[model samples]
Target chain A: MSDVFGVGVIGAGPVTQAIHLPTLARMPDRFRVTAIMDVDEPVAESVAGRVGARHSTSADDLIGDPGVDVVAVCSPHRFHAEQVEAACYAGKAAVLCEKPLALTVADAERVAQVSRETGVPVIVGAMHTFDPGWLGAKANWGDLQETVRVVNSSIVLPWNARYEDWATQILRRPPPGEPVADDALSRSVAVRDAVLGLAVHNLPHVRHFLPDVESVDWAESVDPYGYLVTIRGGGIIARLLGNMHGYWKPSWTLDAWAADQSLHVEFPPSYVQAGSSVATLTSDTQTRRFGGVEANGYEAEWLRVWELAAGIVPQGEDLQATVDDLIYAVRIADAAADLVRGEHARDRVR
Target chain B: MTEFADRPHLVTLPSGPAHRDIAAALASLPRSFRPGAGEDAIVYVTGDDDWPASVEHALSVARRAIVVIQPGYAQPSTVLRLAERAATDSVPVMIDYAFASNPAVVLAAAAWSAAVEPTGILDVTSRHAGDGTGPMAVLLDQLAALHSLVGPVRTIRQLHIDGDAHSAVVAIPVGGGVITATLLGARTELGSRGSRVRWLGPTEALELEVPHAGTAGPGYSRHVTTEGEQLAPTIYENAHRATLARLSRHLEAGAGRCDDLTTLAGHLELVPREHPSRSASQRTSDQRAN
Candidate 1:
């Protein structure tokens, strides 16, 4: 691998234009955009032209490009698994797949197996997991993982379009879908999507404390896009609440408490590069804060990716851990959906 | 609505740890009220222990008015019986819940109703120290605050209590739609003790932060609309002091009616029976056994 690894991105959506591209622009020495591909040819061409990289309408073309050393799979959810597998097989130094690695556990298992077989490391784009603030708290919080009794994750934000539009000028945008029905099946699916799409970013953090999830006590879908779920695991109870509405003030916070210590972290919203999350750890006698880093999670994750590809540092997260994270998210989503379905069925019977 | 011909004297009935705080609030009252003994005085009762019996005693003794500081829980039957007695006696009685009595709550409620449609979810989180009270008390304090801000809780969809932490999802009727409220109470010794209530609507959002009772820390309220975000002016008085001031105003205006008992009863009725089959103590025992 050369000093600067040439990169290929599989999707040119708002995330690519707003988050990854901007982050890559910050690290011109470590990485370079060599190829950009999207099913929308114009978006691929327009985004690639900005960085003076090659443009293509096929993922294979981008992955096979001789100049591309690192591949970023940023396509829709369903294509993430296959594209990642292709990138690994193509002998890329590393692959950065946007979250959910795959929707189904089977697909995740397959991706894990392929990564292990090919020896090409893959990192999921669950940005908060890589946030320096979260890392700092994790390093400093003593015995919280074992002793934590309660965990709460609350995410309240405006629509993504509000932030995406402010972050970058896009060449193409997907149209909004039809309204979701009020029935149980529709609600279950909506909540599942919410967990995978929005809450997935923080599930890794939640799982860090509640490692062995035992059961979901309650789950409900909040209208206009959100979910309220309570799950017990690792001798701790965790509540996850998320709502994406038209509210102007956006608050994304995670709080966990043990008998004698507590951790609270507030993450910046996605799309706009607003530095890193701010975390505070409080003990009975003292409180410590970590944050204000110039680099946000997106930048931090890319830096890690560059380091992993260049063999500067050992793989921080192995294939099995990645698969485990995916499985946990999928299980939580499925459990929540099943609870909603069951409640609705019981209600109908009554 | 006739003003009292003579200045209404204030008297206090002893209760629990909250008595000191209630007395501190009464000491700062304006010159319109004075300390006095006997039934003619405006009786103040801090219902921190045996609230039903204390309120019944106050109703029997007090002739002018009654003010009760809620200790976080009230039985529906007790509240109904007391409310009927207060109504028949034609004495105005106000139940001052710690969080709901904060002046900021009223401001936030008004701004929330005026700025947006009453059709979204209200998120509330209450954090308290483990030593102060049990989970049920903390949850009831939160629910009382919610009742003051919005209306009565219609139904409790789910309630889960694990040790000192309590969480519930309940619905509150608003306009033509129902606003679902997620009430979460966390008891930890490390963080500050307070309650935060938030309502997010399409074009507006409202947030209120009320500190635990007895502390004079200012409660904060932020209202955001399409134009911009506006924060209400901070009030330096604690909830107890504010409740006292409110009662003073009501007495001066000769208001003889209060629905605090009725609302308290309604909320008490809505709280689900404690996990149907297993008592909380039994569940704790089961966990220990496991």
Candidate 2:
């Protein structure tokens, strides 16, 4: 095995900076970020500088590099499927892509298909599957878990505004008559993607705790105000709670109950203090407490990729499971999209 | 002193967890009532400017009122304005150290004899509470000692003291109900005040004095069984270091601003025309000049 795999990073956004690059730097001997590819040259260059890698403005340049063995895709939602397939075609040994695997199942399936033909191991970036809290939960939960009942996950976004500070400024100052994609469908898609992008990171986590998810009969209700999801799988009904309306809820909260016991995990919002998460497990006799540990969601996921590639754990292959979970999450997303579209069509009809 | 029943409605302004804890404790009062969203008679203002008008708007009705001053942080101007407003309507005021970041407010508290409902504010500094000058940690430990002995049945209305030169007391109503243990820590400066220590005085922990039948109603007691000691040594140190670093940053910013670091208001009057030298001895003289 190569002592250090030269990894090509496909996105220079917050995820790459906050999660992927930091985790790679921590374990230098196992993986080295050799290059970065992003549509924005400056962003790619800046991220490359931070991680000490060369920059590529094009995806082809990044995947084609002889020094790059593994490709980590952190691109936008629309671009992930093509990028992943391209990296696989470029003969990269491992292609690790960020989750909500794609905007649609067709895109996710295309990437999945390319991986099947090229024989390159592809992992989605859903690191929550290996969360320390979840690990502790699994340990505390006994095997052959009796009937799984309810899984409640809530991701509250306090500052889920129309745009971030930078994006808001750009939108305000754009040149005249430039077609800005500002429509109900685009807005609804953004909302769906927020759920797909942020919420799906933890789907594998909820699934891990309740391992018998046979089918997901998901219902979604979304308006300009908020989004709420009800998903029933593995005899366990899960509620994903988030209100685009309110500003002060926790970023993520999950409660999973089996026949004899239940697990509760609360994750702090992004860029807050590390290990500031809390987890509680309650059975008939006792309740256990787990918190006061740093959280590195993005870094944790990247580390899993490195560890799996290095043979530290048996395949360290939770990403495939993540893709499967994303498919289920997309069903929720699709339901929400249909509701939103139907509402828009009704408004138009009237 | 116990003559006043729960007449002084405990109003806690929404601050961080500590303020929220105070609100929770006050809300849990058996005879306590939360004024409707638009029916706040008494309003409390703390550090954040998030919710005063909303509170004032909420208290659409009711005549009696109480306002808690955040000790050092509340401006003297703001305090006087509040005092005047309270006086205009004959509203009583119970000043709490909810605003310790501003010295002007602390000084302002000394002014209003009539407008201030309580003759003097309750100060729960470790120095006053007989705990040594270690920090809020030691004071919290002392309080925790009393907290450990209570069963699920006991609850105490506590005036919690920390090493920081601040004090806040809330009515804690615990009646065999599960108590939620919350953790709190922050960076702090090492002050020169002597500890309230003398030899250990009483075998039994102090009891919270409640004034009325309503205040002392069932399901609430002034005794809380100590939960286990939470080790926060590192957290305390981090907070202390951060505070020191912030202070140092402020000092390095410029002389006029750096003078704010001097806790005593008189010292603020003496900030010299020239920047004080880096020498600790020179800084002492600068302090003395005030």
Candidate 3:
């Protein structure tokens, strides 16, 4: 392995162009972009030109390149699992698959199996998991994981374009689609996508305290784009609320409470290169805060990939945890979708 | 405005959850109002005790007005009866909700209602210590706050309630649409204990935070629209003092209808105490079965 790991990114959309490229540009000593791939040749060439890396329209070409030691699967949701498997099978040292690793359980299992079989480390890009503040709270919160009784996750944000335009110049943008149909099936699908697309960013943290989901007590789809879901598990009740609209200021917060202790994390909105989240842990007598650091979760994740590729950390346990996180997120999404569908069916019966 | 021969005397009963705080607020009343005994005295009572009897006694004796502090769980019939008696006697009544009566809440109500779109959800969270009033009281306090900010609650459904936490879904009727409010209450001994109401609309967002009623700390409200962000002016007065000031104003005016009891009756109807005698899991299962 070279002193600086070579990164091959599979998608050059807004996330790749706005988040990853700018993040990698910050850690020049630890990582270098070796190749960029996108379905659009112009987008691939235009984005790759900025970093002086090779551009291609094929995932195979990038994954097979000898210079690409680590692969970042930033393609659309459906392509994540297959590309991750290919990257691991091609003997890459490590792979960073942008969130959801896979949409379905079977695909996620396949990615896990491939990584296990190839002995290649895979890190799903649920950046909050790698956030310095979240990590700090985990280290300092004593017995909170067991004692936590209520967990709440809330996210309210403006459209991604609002922040993406501020993050970097874009080469290609996906065109707007038709509005979602106002029907049971369409609403259920919308909610499922919401859970997997937006809430998946923090379900891993919610599942950390509420490890087992016993039931989804209630689920409702808000108008515009939002969902309210409540699930009970492991003697803890967790409520997840998300809404995306044209609001000016974005708020993303996670709060948990035990009898005498509490944890609160306020994360910066996505697509903006803001620093790490600010986390506060409060006990009966004292309060401690972590994170005023310059490094955001995107940088922290890449550093983790560099560590895994350089053999600075073991892959066995971390790989299983990644798979477990994926399973947790899938369980939540499936349950919420089913509940929403059931409610809609009942409404129609009435 | 009617001119009284002398200032109205303030009388505070020593009962209920916030008796000590109410007493302190009465002691700090402005010179226009005095604390003593008189026929036209303003009666203050919190609802945790035998409030019906206390309010009845106040109605019989006081000629000026009545102020109820943090009415806990009251039967709709009982509250309506009290409202009728207050009406017949022509004694104005005011309910002092810890968070709702904050000066900041009063200032932000107009902006909040004007800018908030009904399409999205309104999130309300209240954190309290378990050693304080129980979860029911805390929930009622939140409902009162909501009533003040968004008007009457049209419907409410209890999602879950255990030893330390309570969750409910409520719908408030806005101009032409109904906005859903998700209310969550948790009992914790840590953190800055308070109640927070937040709403994010398409082009505007409003968040209001009110500290515990015991302190005179200023409640904070922030409003953000496309144009820019604005914060409501801070006021260092707790709910008790503010409620007293409101009652003083009502007395000085002498002829306004008091709807506190009516609103409380409406809020109580939305959260009836006689929930189904089944576990939350069983209730959820039954809902799914239906």
Candidate 4:
């Protein structure tokens, strides 16, 4: 593979239209967009034309192209596992996919199994895990895992347009997906999707403070929007909240508490490089704030993919950890759905 | 304001939490407060004596009375018994919740209740430095202020909690509107302050922050309206004073029905204990009719 790898992205939707394109545009020396694929031909062509890349309605064509060294998967939830597996088997230098790894633990395991078999490094993108501030907390986190009392993760998101507007000015966006109707099949799918999409980012992030989740105590879907999840076990407890339809400004913070010390990390919204996440360490004697990092997690994730692409990562970089994070998110989501189901059952009895 | 002019004597408990501030708040108003009751009536019972009987005797002699409580440290049954006696004896009773008179909470409650739509969410938090049974005092104050902002909560959901932090969302369906309260307890900030009561209203957002409870200084506040920003003016520097002022008004109006027992049971019922949330919840259910 050349120093500058030619990329073939499978989905030309929002993640590509807004995030990855702007990110790749900034790193001209290491990466280049060679092809774009989408089921919607116009969207694929329109995005491909902007980056001077070829457009194809068939994802297989894009994945099989000789000029495409790195294959990035940014498709819908269902296609993640199969697409990444195909990229790995196709002898691509690197495979990058957005979160959930796959929707279920079984699928995530399959993705990991395929990656291990093919030996083509796969990057599962949950950007906050790669955040500089979070990483700094991980580095400076002395025995927090053993001594931690609680890990509280809160995110108050108003609307995506508030932050997404800062990243890309999309005059014409993709058509909206259909809302899940209130039915059995749809409800099951909705619960899983809510986990895969929303809680996946946070559950794994909280794991940095308290890695082993002994059991989830409680989980619920808030009235109209949001998920409230609590995990407790092994002398540590974690609470994660994600409100999709909040009417206030966006607020995101992850705080970990020890007996005398705690680490608080505040993250800016995704896609936008507003500022690095700020981490503050407070002990009995002194309080210190860390703001030294430059690159945001979005950029850092791309750089990590580059590291995997360049074979510069250290030994024992098990891709299974990424799969585990996704599984952890799925388990929490499943627990939340079960809680909602139990509430429904109780309501019926009442 | 000569409601208690003849027997201008007020009896109170230990001058801690909101008691001192309540006294100061009363002192600021004309003919609202009395310094002496001619008896040392603030019985430091420590769950040892008949607190209700003591309160009844004090109220029988004095014109009005105030009971201070730190719900976490004090017995709820003791405080409730005293408040119930004062209410039954037709004596004006001011049972001030922990730091309920903080100016920030007062303003946030007022703003939310006064909104045109009067429907919003209240986020009340306390910064604490303590052991694992964390910030229980602040949690009580938050619940009291939450009651004041909306009404008595009708629905509660324990959303997120851990060793040092406990978060719950409660909704009050009072009159024609519903106001939700989000309560969070933070265990890191060391100052016996750093409490916040924020209201997200239909027309604007009001955030009231208290750095130190019952301090002489005016806690910081910001109101973001559709037009622009407006900072609320401090009425009383301390919330205890505000609570006292409210009690005076209630006594003057001859308002009966003390919320003491119900509020206490509600809190002890709603909040999850460190070890046994289900048992506490069952206790709340069992004693709810009491």
Top-scoring candidate (TM-score): 3
DockQ of each: 0.46, 0.01, 0.58, 0.23
lDDT of 1 at A30: 94
lDDT of 3 by residue, A255-330 (tens): 9988889999999998888999999999978889998588999999999998899999888677678778888988
Model 4: runs farther than 4 Å from truth?
Answer: A172-191, A246-248, B1-64, B73-81, B90-92, B114-124, B130-138, B155-171, B174-182, B186-189, B197-208, B212-236, B244-262, B265-290
lDDT of 3 at A108: 84
Model 2, chain B only, scores a TM-score of 0.30
All candidates' chain B TM-scores are 0.83, 0.30, 0.85, 0.66
Model 1: per-residue Cα lDDT over A264-335, one tens digit each: 999999998999999999998999999868889988888888888998876655567878988999999999
What lDDT does candidate 1 reach at residue A176?
38
Instruction: State how far residue A272 of model 3 sits from its true place (Å).
Output: 2.1
What tens-digit string does per-residue lDDT give for candidate 3 at B195-235? 89988676677889988777889988988787778888878
Q: Please name the candidate that would achieve the greatest DockQ relative to the true structure.
A: 3
Q: What docking grade does candidate 1 earn?
A: acceptable
User: What's model 1's lDDT at B92?
Assistant: 77
Cα lDDT for residue A83, candidate 4: 93
Chain A agreement with the truth for model 3, given as TM-score:
0.96
Give the whole-model CA lDDT for all candidates, comma-separated: 0.80, 0.46, 0.82, 0.65
Better of 1 and 2 by lDDT: 1
Structure candidate 3, residue pairs in collision: none
Residue A150, candidate 2: alpha-carbon lDDT:
49
**lDDT assessment of candidate 1:** 0.80
TM-score to true structure, per model: 0.91, 0.49, 0.92, 0.82
Best by lDDT: 3
Model 1 alpha-carbon drift over 4 Å, by segment: A171-176, A345-350, B1-8, B13-16, B30-49, B61-66, B90-93, B115-118, B130-133, B255-257, B274-290
